[model samples]
Target: MSETRKCMVCGQIFKLRAQCPHQRYCSNRDCQRERKAQWQKLKVKSDPDYRENQRRAQTRWSELHPDYWRRYRDMHQAYKERNREQQRVRNSQSRQVAKMDVSVLDSRLCSGLYVLTHAVCGDVAKIGAWIVHLTVISDLPVESLKIAKR
Candidate 1:
């Protein structure tokens, strides 16, 4: 058996394995989380000027390296797509039934006026009913409106 080495992470002594050499943490997740937390703490403690410099350096690097920037963007997009798909699957599994509320329509205008207008127009039959209604009520000409499809 090979000699044991101390883990820099939890400070636990572990036997050297054939797969990994100088392993700081037992698993990849533990190592990644520790590194992320360490960097986050460092960033928090860093001066404003230092953070600005780092941001500028990153921007300059991306500007100077188009290929690197493209690859990084592609990888980020792929990761986002995968994560979104996983979230959609998980959400679809725990589907819930929601009830819609029905309320009575109360209008201050007289019922006779409402009935005459509704009779002249079949329940505001088209998309631009509000505009048309306003035009008709205000004695304005209804212009030929071109409705765009979404």
Candidate 2:
């Protein structure tokens, strides 16, 4: 006979398997998935070697399939839109990305030296965003930044 225990993930009562006495998650797929996720998170936090290996593996995978994300995004419109929205929030609060309404932020744009970055296609909005407290790399005046007719 095995002792009954509560599942750590779903909080459901389950009996420990006779073979596995230290099982923290039940046989449920979701619970097993959550258990693995929690275990991986802990491993990454505690093991520097594991974290570095995982990063290297991910980099290798990305290099092997550079267009994987692009193809996935193309196949999944909702995913693409969600990522774009999150990116907008990230851009708006580049110092600290958080979930909040951008419209509530200060709308006034101060005239100062700002860094210009190219926006990726279909991701960034038309409104310009630049870093604050920008260091001027050149002695050129701010007015010189404006472009004239070609």
Candidate 3:
């Protein structure tokens, strides 16, 4: 009978066997790898419409699983912050070649004048002028500039 037929490769076919009619590979590994490669090739050849559909699918999934999306976003943001901090440390170390040390001046000595004195230069007159201008124009009170060493 047609139901009792055998496969050519494995030769152990049973009733209602082989879900895929076109399946030739008998091994599960070969079958899975073949399917994966086919899917990858198809995705690679897909047009903008296919990509839009995928985006819509992801949006629907996020809507359906709001908690999952929120957790994913939080994890992604934390990862980005960690990467940025690491990069900042690395950049600061590299910038030591041309970096100038800044000395914190005592507020009592400068009479409440917050001066950012650079060791490379005796007086940062331009920066001092800008700070003074900001103090006059902005809502920030001039008293806030009391230079306290961290």
Candidate 4:
């Protein structure tokens, strides 16, 4: 058997296993959490393009599922209610503070196509959605469309 090594995060002596040849952390929960956090920190610091790519991917995913969080909260109403109750308790204990929430609207132009595939209006709805999107895009000035394309 090999000698036990000290954990990098908690300095606790831990045995190495065949599964993980370079196990630097003990089986402690806090040590594992700290190890993961340190690895993520180093990854972000060492890779410059990684953050930008991650942001772009997140934005694309959010655009694809705009109502994902709303649906999740609705499905987990009990969890949402518990969170609201905890927030209310914290607010009651502290003095009221006024806060202004600012959000910037994006200027990029994109259209969503919603088709109701019912028995009567399946093809009609698709054709109508395409026609509407085309009409809206054509209404924009040529310069605006060019800028939007950028």
Best model number under lDDT: 2
For model 2, which pairs clash?
A: none
Backbone clashes for every candidate come to: 0, 0, 0, 0
Per-model CA lDDT versus the true structure: 0.58, 0.76, 0.57, 0.68
- lDDT by residue for model 3 (1-150), tens: 334444444555544445656554445565557666777669847777776787899899988987984577577998778878999999987753333454443454433333344345434443432212212233345577554579
Q: Per-residue alpha-carbon lDDT of model 4 for 1-150, expressed as tens digits?
A: 865899998787889877889888988999989988888788778887977786799999999999998999999999899989999999886533322342232466444323334243233322223212122335445544444333
In order of appearance, the predictions have TM-scores of 0.32, 0.57, 0.29, 0.40
Model 3 alpha-carbon drift over 4 Å, by segment:
1-34, 37-41, 69-150
In model 3, how large is the Cα lDDT of residue 95?
Answer: 52
Ranked by lDDT, the better of candidates 2 and 3 is 2
- Lowest summed lDDT across 10 adjacent residues in model 3 is found at 129-138
Q: Candidate 1 vs. truth: CA RMSD?
A: 14.5
Number of the candidate with higher lDDT, 1 or 2:
2
Residue 150 of model 3, lDDT score: 94
Point out the higher-scoring one by lDDT: 1 or 3. 1
